[model samples]
Target: MPAWTDRALLCLLLAAPAGLFLGCSEGTGAEDVGIVCDPGEGQMCTCASGLGSVAWCRIDGTGFLPCECEAGDEGFGGETAGDGDGDGDGDTGDGDGDGDTGDGDGETGDGDTGDGDADTGDGDGDGDPILDQACYPGPNDDYSVCFPIVVPAPLPAGYDYPAPYQGNPNYRAPVRYLDLDAIDQSAQVAANFTLDEFAQSWKGRYAVLQPHAVAYVQDLRDVVGPISVNSGYRPPAYNAMVGGAGSSRHIYGDGFDLDPIEVPLATLEAACSNNAGFLVEYESHVHCDWRNVDVDVGFFGLPNGDAPNELPLLAASLEQDPHTGHWSAPASGFDEGEPVRRWTAFAADDRVLTQARGRTFEAPPETAYVEVLVGARMRLVGEPLSRRE
Candidate 1:
């Protein structure tokens, strides 16, 4: 090697070591590097071991210090934690295990790590609102029963009867009526009552007051007798057998028949006036309900003219005709030759009374007699009438 080259190489090696030593030399030694970081200098330095990395420290306390450069791809950069120790237990679950916070129930899931307590006394089933475990809101209204009175808005035209009112529970009548007092049903439900005893006990005259007819009679009381119940839940087939095959509503639980007492249907209707939905008379009986129809049934004269409408059933006029259990309704407009009888017991006040029937199998033109039921209202109508339109 040339003499000049050797000297230059030796000088370069020595300088490189000197630079490294100075840069990495800041130590915790008290007297060591008084080199402090100075903001004015816009530069600072840190120790190689990162002894005081909080920031902006220096060697001589004020002059511009060299910048310490750490490796480029370092993962973490921060002050190492002190040796301080707290409770060693790393259990991080909430007090309770319900997965809920604060309202500790004591159940803890390491993965689901939460307090799992369920019964929180909150109406919502969750202890806390934010942590409410319940999904749906509770029912604010009734969840269990049909109210004592089932009412639909926009009442129907006539009375809406659910099933035959098992009648008021407290109601009872005479032996002639049913001997309710004799049978002592003031407190009982199904008395050992027979159809005959039920019949002989009829103060209301008609046998429709038979079986259940008697029970219905008790409902009328001194108000009147022969207060027959013509149609008390008859099946659809019976209405069909009786020529009601066309518009029979017996299929639905919402149908019933009304039998007039002594007056004419016109009088009963006139009494109702504009409120005529409840007093509609068909060939057989008065159709009293609350729902109105698009077409009035009066044209067929079921409520008035006999024109082959339905029947004109009479409570007092019932005979032991061979049709014992089943009796045919009389034609509209009684035959002039046929005897016309007057029922007084079922009549009272300025008002008249009548029986309730199912369907009538006659046409119109015949003047149907009057059958007025007392207490014009109060009858409860159940389900909708079958759409027999």
Candidate 2:
């Protein structure tokens, strides 16, 4: 027997766990020496070589298990199952066993067991316990996994829905909601304003509220009595359909197009002028919102639904409606028209002209401007300029 052959057998015996003697020579049955061959599903079979080495291969339902050694150690006078060059250190094996440099791990898959660079070759990646799994795409893309979306909770009490949005499917945020049509009268949101009256005609399915804006409405009610809302919380789709402002605060559930049901429009406008928040008085209705920023208040009349005949030189508070052919004024309306005249007019000392480019023309130091428009559509022409004395 070669001296190296004796050393190889000794190494295999030492490496075996417990008192199991994996070293072998001749026809020693694997089961006789307690070598188990129970390769379960999705697993490969492994066998010990004649020289105490191992061989690993996938068991593809063939019922063919590697239970015996191929041969003893070549130089030791027996055929060895390991393809190693017979010194039996298990190094440089035929790439089929759990030798130090063998290809197989003596298990299924790649066959390499708990040895260096000898894995099941399953692409488990580094075999690290923390990161052995495959990569996952994400909740949005991966439909196989269930992911939860965060939404505001604690919806308002007694708020029922129509057939479609009932029970709040798809997990959308819910605030206070009121359906005037479904609910009874006398349950007024304010004086002369009931959910059945003002909110009953709301086109949108939901009516959310920002607490601050609600408080503003309450305050306005104290001064001007009952107020009616023409428009309130509008969904993005509905807002776009109705040609609402692209950046309208109504979409954010904090704005309202309102009108005085009992009090005069001027009285409501005057009350808004003395308070905080945004207020814009149109010909009929008053647009109010709780922006919580600088208090911006303005007044403009929509006498007709047509473009202004003459564009104002200094007073540029005239705008044309593309759909209705009506001329109206909105916040930042001056920037839309071309400056036709640059005249001065007598204005109150406290009057402030808000114009394009955030420019403020004061009445005391600067003259107030009044522009008059003529014609059917009120298209502003360059020829005539109206100045107020």
Candidate whose lDDT is highest: 2
Over 291-343, each residue of candidate 2 has an lDDT whose tens digit, in order, gives 44211100000011112222112233444334443333323322112222222
Q: On a 0 to 100 scale, what is the lDDT of residue 281 in model 2?
A: 46
TM-score of each: 0.20, 0.33
lDDT of 1 by residue, 183-231 (tens): 3222211122223332222222211122122222233322332323355
Where does model 2 exceed 4 Å of error? 1-192, 195-202, 293-389
Which 10-residue window in model 2 sums to the lowest lDDT? 295-304
* lDDT of residue 8 for candidate 2: 13
